[model samples]
Target: MTYTRFAIYDAPSDDALAEFGATWLGWDIRTGCATDQPDVHGLDDITMTPRKYGFHGTLKPPFRLATGTDVGGLQVAVTEMAATCAPTKSGGLALTTLGGFLALIPTGDLSGLERVAGACVRALDPFRAPQSKADLIRRRKAGLSARQETLMLRWGYPYVMEEFRFHLTLSARMPDQDRAQWFQTAQANLPPLNEIYAIDSIALCGERADGRFELIQRYALTG
Candidate 1:
């Protein structure tokens, strides 16, 4: 299949969490199909934003392939990079509201996760096409700091390396008054939250013509 863009993600390997995420989002990115969502009121509207990408934490943001690079070469580079990245563990995950949106975020020590994210951001960057001028303008509208601007220019994304915060989004930005209700729904529907979020593998995802991302491959961290 032809892909317009590619990204690296840390998708859930745990069956329960994976299933819950796929169902909740109404898209099984791993399987490249839509899922039957639960009949909860307003569930579809709230999840519309994150449904395209499925349940995963971003290791590297999406980018178009560079002029000379192809998916095959990209795969080889990812494999080689993964071989040098030892698996890392995090304190765990928690369902929380982040800047008005619901998400699963890591708690406690994040150094290991940070290291893995940093490595992915740097090592595979050669395959990333430079951000378009409009893209840069859109990013700057978020009021970037000097450091963020530098990172954006260098990495084509401002939120990488020191700025990276791993999260699995569960909903669109909702009104503050509606936050508690959605949070409760998410909690009730979710599997038991992880007590130890381990980074054992990373997935290569491709954006289909329909704009939904689908899992292409998962590379284990063996180093």
Candidate 2:
């Protein structure tokens, strides 16, 4: 079985996004239970792609372990890294369409978010297995830009550091009409994020035998 780790954040259980993910994805990573979907047209098919990923924005993209490194060692390193990093506060999140998909995006400066994510990519890199030829060829089919190719070759995933935009995906790409409707419904379903949310914790997640990712542990940003 292949194992991959991801650094992810969350929305409080009572939060709108929390419920949105539960209903849309059929499972809540936090509760680890199946959930009911909202009664909306094309909801099931539209969410099929991200449903497999559950919810939460990607920090460190998934990758297998490198030789000489194991989950035990990776856990220790992640814990230490979280302790040294400080949590960040953003202007809050807005539900909007990003590249034909629906997601929650930060409304203000994201320098702090960038720092934390970049650190995760760098500090835990030794644990990541290099991208294989198959992976590269598959990714290239998406038609990467020159910079994206560079980042992919270096980090195993293209979107990182300077290229990263923090977004918690709500749905996969859809037709314009579907995207518009979902955006409106999502804005209504998601809880109001008028206050500050501290990006203070990082959850360590791993893919299970079933191909679904599960939250293994969460480390607080102590610094």
Q: Which candidate is the best by lDDT?
A: 1
Winner by TM-score = 1
lDDT of 1 by residue, 1-223 (tens): 9999999999999999999999999999899999999999999999998999988899999999999999999999999999999999988789999989999998899999999999999999999999999999999999999999999999999999898999999999999999999999999998887789898999999999999999999999998
TM-score to native of every candidate shown:
0.98, 0.92
- For model 1, the superposed segments whose C-alpha errors exceed 4 Å read none
- Prediction 2 global C-alpha lDDT: 0.78
Model 2 per-residue lDDT tens digits across residues 96-175: 88899998788777889889999888989989988889999999998889999999999888889788988888888988
Candidate 2 segments whose C-alpha is farther than 4 A from its true place: 1-16
